[model samples]
Target: MRRILIVGAGQAGLQLALGLQAQDYDVTVMSNRTADEIRGGRVMSTQCMFDQALQHERDTQINFWESQAPRVQGLGVSVAAPDGSRAIDWLGHLDHYAQSVDQRLKMAGWLETFAQRGGQLVVHGAAVSDLDFFARTYDLVLVAAGKGELVSMFARDAERSPYDAPQRALAVAYVHGLGPRPEHPDTEAVRCNLVPGVGELFVIPCLTTSGRCDTLFWEGVPGGPLDVFRDIKDPAEHLATTLELMEKFLPWEYARATKVELTDAGGTLAGRYAPTVRKPVGRLPGGGAVLGVADVVVANDPITGQGSNSASKCAAAYLAAILEHGDRPFDEAWMQATFDRYWETARHVTTWTNAMLAPPPEHVVNMLGAAGELQPVADRFANGFNNPADFEEWFYDPAKTEAYLASVTG
Candidate 1:
């Protein structure tokens, strides 16, 4: 059995470790935190997994929270006017529901499951110096840690990475007492409110360690009025600031969240990072190289909620490539080829996310306007969040969007 070592027990690392172990390959996973620590730690992200990504988990038998988590059946978008009034309001239905299980719950549960499956689980803070030693022992080493000094091991691919600075100053608070949407109380959906030149706010239903709750996420344009959470350390303060911001930019959502309070002391997180794509191969001290996976290689801004979904897809894609390689050596060529396969899917996500970070192009604005009047257009746009590849057909190009709109309207 060829030994494989995966560093970082995140969505990508754990998924790959488990998949390889299931195939009877020798696998070991290293994580900075233990399951207990993760369960008791601060919330990591607002990860909403769409239909196809959820199916990937089910196929791998890792869909532990599917039965308990809230189901997001569609998408609700409201673009706020300069005066804070709703300019365009629409709800797009999705054919299949998406789900968000807090990373604390999901990652902790997955760590336990990986160990139970006979895969080695090592809990420790791994750095570049550590990778030098690990590279000598394992047949292949994959670094999947999304952040920190470890990620610096891989050089940034300047041509592929579009941004040098952070796109949004992000703040997230998970809270209780968030009332349902008035129009669709029974159907849970990911609600997004866009305040052009200010920021975007997302209200996502999710299952946290404290049970079901809603996550209030802010993606503020840097130095803008919405960028107001730099000094907030208390969860209560975070919740309060969130409500205050909502009241200013998304009053409808603020009204719905009037009774909201933090779910727990650790339910809030605030930070920022540049959306980057790094070379998939990381060179060790002497001469050895390790492969990068998921966020470690392609970290995108959370504007589109594609991080976890992309991680899930990357895990499945890498698993297939590994299995197909059979007894072949895991060489530099193989590593590049594996990442190239995953990049085909990731490029779509990166492109879509980057498009969303900027001001809406005229065609996109037209599309949103049409969506308010056309149910099919709304539904297709809503479903596009699940399978972003569908976007390439009509989203990126103004001419294609115009042609599609004409065909549908006629």
Candidate 2:
């Protein structure tokens, strides 16, 4: 049994750990917080797992919340006009459903699962110095902690990373009593409202520690009017401010959010990070080599909600890479090749997501508008959430978009 140490207990780390445990490899995970501490903590992210990613969890038998979580069946996008009315509005159907389960519920539950099943769980914050020591005992070490001092060990891959600073000021609140979209009275969907200059608003239905709820999130363009959540520490004030913004910029959404209340005192999250891609291997001061996983290596802005999805896929891809190596030394060459396998898919996600951060080019804008008139186009756009690679075929190029539109319209 080869011993492995994972320095983070997030989706990628935990999933990979559990998968290795089942295969009878000696596995250990280090988490900064215990399961109970995590359960009692604040919301972490605005994450929604689409079909492809969810299937990976199901394959590993780690999708314990499947029956309890709401199945978000589609995505509804509305571009706000100058007066806050919808300039173009349509709901695109996903071939299969997606879901959002709060990390407070998921990471905590997964932590417990990893421990309950005889995998070693270390409750401590791991730094590079810690890994320098642990590397002597474990045959392999992977860092999945996306944020922390540990991330600095993995240098940024300048060629792959474009932004040096954050593009959006993010704010999120989980609440109960958010009414359904009246237009799609029976649909369980994610709503994305795009405000050209200010930012974007997304309403995600999710299952949390409390039960099913909605996550009202904002991605404000940096230094823009909506970039205003940094100073408000009070959860009530945070929510109130969220509602006020909705009323002003997305009136229709505000109409339904009028009576909502926080799911708990810790149901709000506010912060920002630049989308970055880092080298796969982290080198310790003591000459120990460590591998970086998921957001630690390839952090997308979450503008397209790919954080959790990408993490799950990364774990799966790495699991396959490890299982195939069959006792090969986990060296720098192995780590880079492992990441290269995951990047085959992650590259598409990074490309599509990065493009969304900029104002859409005329061709992209035309395609979005066309979705309103073409059901097939809307369906393709919505389904792209599951596989962003599809966008490359028709979404990025002017000539491709023009040809695809002509083929569809006729």
Candidate 3:
């Protein structure tokens, strides 16, 4: 059996390890925290996985929370106006429902499941030196956790990475009691409110350790008024600040947020990371080569909410690559080729996500405006979240946007 060591226990690493285990390969996973620690830790993200991404989880049989989580049927976009009204508002229905499960609940459960299946679990913080030693014993070592010094092993791909600083100061609070949009009270949806230069707010329905709840997230333009979570030491204070900003910039959303409370003491989170694409292979000091996985190689900002989905796809793609390689040595050439294959799909996501960090071109703005008047345009935009690659078909180009709008409106 081919021996593989997967480092990091986030969505990608754990998913890949579990997949390999199911294949009956000799697989071992290293996690920095025990399942208990992860279960007790703060929420990791507002991971709302659309159809394709969710399908990857189902294919692997790890989607344990699907039955309990809220089914987000569509996504609504409202451009906030200076007069406290919506300048442009529309809700685009997704063909398939998306769902979010707190990482605390999912990761911990996955960690235990991996062990229950007889897969070796190493509960230790892995360093470069540790990998160098492990490489001598394991036929392949893959880095899935992007945090810590392990990230330094992958060189930044400057050509593909467009930003050096975080585009947004991100903050999130998992809460209970968030009411649905008044107009769509009977429907569950992901609400995205854009405050022009200020930034964007996302209200996502999710399932947490405490059961059904919502994630109120803010992606504040750096140094903007909403980028004020730096000193928040209390979760209640964080929720209050989130509410204050909502009241000022998104009164309609605040109308429903007034009575919401944090889901738990560790339910609030604040941080930011620049979007970057790194070389696929991580080199160790001992000349051992390890492959970087998912966010370790292509870490995009969560503004587009593609992080978890990208991770799931990355794991699935890599699993296929590994299986196909058979007994062949997992060399640098193979590692680069595997990543290149995944990038065929990921590049589209990268392009669309990076474009969003900048001011939308007039043509792009026009398309969004047109979406409000046309259901086809709205549905296309909504489903693009499931397949961001579709945006290149009509979203980015002025000519194509014009042609598409004309086709739908006429």
Candidate 4:
């Protein structure tokens, strides 16, 4: 059996390790935190997996929260005026629903599951020097660490990475007792409120460490009204600040969240990191090359919520490449080729996500206006969040968006 050492027991690392282990490969996963620690720790992300990503997990038999997690059936989009009144509001129904399981619950469960499946688990942080040591033993070493020192080993790909700094100051809180949209009380949808130059707010229903709860994810433009969670350490204080911000910028959401309370002491997180794409192959000190996976290779801001989905697809692509190599060397060329295969899909997500971070283009603004009047246009836009590749056909380009809008409206 070919031996593999996967650094970082995240969605990508754990999934790939488990998948390879099931195929009888000698897989070992390294994690900084143990399963119990992760289960008891703070929330990691607002991970809402759409149909495609969820299906990938199901295909690998690792989707454990489908029955327990809340089902997000569609997307409710609203553009808020500077004064906090809704400018344009519409509901886009999805053909297939999406689901968000808190990473604290998901990752911890997956880490334990990987061990149960006979994969070795290393409970320690691995550095570049550590990778050099691991390189000698494993046939291949994959760096799936989402952030920190290990990821810096891979040089940024200047040509592919567009941003030089963090696009938005991100803050998130998982709370219980967030009321549903008044218009759609029975429906569970990702309610996205865009504040134009200010930033965006996403109210997502998710399965938290405790139980089902709502995640209020704020993407605040630098120095914007929503950028207020930097110094708050206490969860209750964070929730209060978030509520205050919402009341000022998104009164509708504030009204819905009036009865909100933190799910736990560790329910809030706030930080900022630039979105970047890095070289797929990172070099070790002694001439060994380690392959980068998931966020380590292509880290995007949570603005589009594509992080977990992209990681899932990346694992699937890399798994296919490894299975196809069939005793061949895991060389630089193979690593590059595998990343390119995944990039074909990921590029759309990156492009779409980057586009979302900027001010809406004229055509996009027009499309949003049209969506309020047309259900098909709204549904297409809503579903685009599920499969970003669809955006290439009608969203990114002005001509395509206009033509698509005309066809739908007519």
For model 3, the stretches where C-alpha displacement exceeds 4 angstroms are none
What RMSD value applies to candidate 2? 0.7
Task: Provide the lDDT at 288 for model 1.
Answer: 86
* Lowest lDDT block of 10, candidate 2: 323-332
Say what the RMSD of model 3 is.
0.7
Report the C-alpha lDDT of model 1 over 292-343, residue by residue, as the tens digit: 9999999999999999999999999999998999888888899999999999
Clashing pairs in 2: none
Q: How many pairs in model 2 have backbone atoms within 3 A of each other, for residues 3 or more apart or on separate chains, i.e. clashes?
A: 0
Model 2 misplaced regions, further than 4 Å: none
Residues 1-410, model 3: lDDT tens digits: 99999999999999999999999999999999999999999888878899999999999999998999989999989999899999999999999999999999999999999999999999999999999999989999999988789999999999999899899999999999998788999889998899999999999999999999999999999999999998898898999999999999999999998889999999999998989999999888889899999999999988888999999999999999999999999999999999999898799889989999998899988888888999888889989999999998899889999998988878
Task: Report the lDDT tens digits of candidate 4 across residue range 1-410.
Answer: 89999999888988898889879999999999999999999888888888898888998998899999998999988999866689999999998999999888888999999898888999998888888888988899999997888887899999989998998999999999998888999999998999888888999999987899999999999787777788888888888888888898899999989898899988999999889999999999988999999999999999888889999999998999999999988999999999999999999999999899989989999999889999999999889888998999998789999899878867
Q: Looking at candidate 1, what is the lDDT of residue 102?
A: 94
List candidate 4 segments past 4 Å from native.
Answer: none
- Candidate 1 residue pairs in clash (backbone atoms < 3 Å): none
Off by over 4 Å in 1: none
* Residue-level lDDT for 227 in candidate 2: 91
